[model samples]
Target: MTGRSGGFGDHSLKTLEESRKTYLQSLRVSTADATFFSHQNALRKFFSWYSPTANKPDSPGNTLAEFAKHLLTTLGQSVDTVAGHIHSLLNFLAFHHQSSPDELRVRLFSEIQLLSCPESAKESLSKEFGFQAGSEITRSVDALRAYLRQRQYGTRTHAYVELILAARARPTQIRLLNRSDLHLDEQTASIPLSETYLIAATGLHNEQTVDLPPDLTNVLETYIEHERKTPSQSGCQPLFTTIHGRASVGTLRRSVKLASEKARDYHCATRETNPDDRSPVDSVTAVVPSDIYRVALSDVENTS
Candidate 1:
């Protein structure tokens, strides 16, 4: 359903091309470089679909609305991705027709509403952390961090764990990061939008800056200075690496899993035991990178 534009008349095609160019030029001054490119790509896709070359008998009497449905249903894009496309299309329409996007959306797409279905905080914690309670999850994370800091500090394992906990990033995002992305002095790291899962999940188009906690910054500094190896290749400076080269996503996940298990075992073994009382450490759950992200979202919702 995407990139099929067989029905548009030549005049319509020319108008779309001109309007797209003018709209992008207008956006250039106000938007960031990554945002400009994202808008450009989204509009190109929208124009491809907007071509009168294709016909739909059940178009809901609105082209934009029909395209939105196609993006969600036929293309199977996440709601966030679909919203980006709709946003770009609305802005383009507003530019060409001299109307506000809000007015255009209401007049043309009043019946369409974009919504997302995600795991509830409790469900997410149970699924990802194997814990039903947020408090237990927090305790597990604290134990894991404490174990890493005391025993594995300055190693790749410690850096990876601290990075995920601080950044609340998926392993996929971490895999795409590079050493150049880190700004240790500023306590931030940039995640590029291209091929990033964060873009699909969060509706962020431009490069994303993840704020680093001071502890993570210090840990990263130690790892880089003493433990990290130079990339085997000249131009590839992956932020996380192994003895060979850049660390794979599998490596990061395995490291996280192992670290969590070790923490659980360490805490369970050393905990003061009473014959009468059930050990609280018995319920401690293993952590994963995604659990951190879910917990972070839950925190934000609670605070808001």
Candidate 2:
């Protein structure tokens, strides 16, 4: 009947208008005095819909239980979330009215019990209540790194994962490395080598003038001359470069992974075949093993 053309007569509409004015004034007063403006507004709206008498402290048919239920249903919140909100509202109302928490209605009292528990305990209880937490080991840092490394990760990409793992273990710093970080000298050759070459000469780190076996030295010299030459082409870096002519972390990671896999494959194939076997030639045993190749280089340097 509040200023509407309904079944109510003019007298009823006038009473409704007066009630609306009084309710608005009450809301304004409560909003001014309320500690939380949001809570005051919500309570004011609820009171307006349920009870129009503003001056009375107690309103007929105003129950905290019904209000809590209405709030939860209207908000479409989970049980735990609804319980927390109701508990907060109950506490706020009790404090505003200068009453004890115990004086709150049963619905809010029950919610307060649920909210008072420690978060860890509540999670445990929730699990016990059949709320399963989503968890997977496949998404772990190590697992993801391994997968990416297999797919040929670049240097920068590997560095980032390494940083994350290091941080997880303990706080640490990652320093950038450059070619200058490597110690290189003509006098000493700490180059890695294969077992066959190591058997021929003793290895030393940063040693000068290691003699290399003539044959191995010649092969190495040829390889270096052909493959390690300074590029005549513009925009090319010999030490490292991407297909597009730029060094990248992903490219480096992928190269190392591919190299390792090739080495492993060669080792396995050689191990399975007999050197004295008269069968057709094995492709794996035909290629130089990483260890043997490295030893050949060391032997060449040592003999030379």
Candidate 3:
């Protein structure tokens, strides 16, 4: 707040409004009539909920994340809807960055690029992106599974991905898991899908558990022994932790976003119908973390 502080400062109300107006004016130059209006509408929706907190020092990475989740859960917005809103917010961040002091650009710009558009799609790719149906959700999940497994960091993040896609764990639940919480035994058991041990993961309800497959059990073991960093303090071990101790919410979100992006083998048209006749139809232009994220959120809601 004192001097830009390297990234967008929600702590300052005056600056946030000024920055929004400035960005909107600049956005007019690059965006068409529809695009510009759409973004303006999104910004209005955001400002309706965002009340500036005074002197609340927080990381931009984390603050923006909470803002996004609030839009989804509290505001009850869908992934694509939230994505459109975030896309607008991201541009505002970038535009503000350009006019801010130079040193702050590096960190501010990094947040912009990381949060911008979830994942990059080539211009050569077709438009029209979203998870249009429950079946499309399935396909996207499968694709994301494979993509996460193939990445080098995948070894580290793959377990959480499985928990999300298979077990339907929320980000908060994943963050709260301890290394010891996993009921993994060194001797592999021939467990069936339905019979696999429950995760005992704490969520909205305290007694939550989920089925874990043998392959994923192995992956968890490998991660614990090889990929995971040893905790400095005796009580610090988490089921999945970054070098920073615990995976930040932003890290978890971005990991899911990357997986979703990679899952898109080809760009979809600007509009396309869901092929499933059984489920209600929707046309989506992009797949994002929320597609995966909402599963866990809904799971908790249903169970609760």
Tens digit per residue, CA lDDT, model 1, 1-304: 0101112224365786887776787567656888788888888777767655556422221566567667766777766676676666756664454332333344333224221223332232123222122777777777788788877898887887677555544456667778999999888887553332222222323345667878889999999999988876777788888767788878877887789889888777667554553657566679876665445433421221
Ranking of candidates on lDDT, top first: 1, 3, 2
Q: Which stretches of candidate 2 lie over 4 Å from their true place?
A: 1-35, 52-62, 74-81, 95-97, 105-304
Clashing pairs in 3: 127-269, 128-270, 128-285, 129-284, 129-285, 129-286, 130-284, 130-285, 130-286
Which wins on TM-score, candidate 2 or candidate 3? 3
Maximum-TM-score candidate? 1
Give each model's whole-structure lDDT.
Answer: 0.61, 0.33, 0.50
Please, what are the lDDT tens digits per residue for candidate 2 over residues 217-260?
A: 33333333343334355642433333344344445445434544
In terms of lDDT, the poorest run of 10 residues in model 1 is 1-10
* Model 1, TM vs. native: 0.53
Q: After superposition, how far is residue 39 of candidate 1 from its true place, in Å?
A: 13
Residue 183 alpha-carbon offset, candidate 3, angstroms: 0.6
Positional deviation of 108 in candidate 1, in angstroms? Answer: 26
RMSD of model 2, in Å? Answer: 29.3
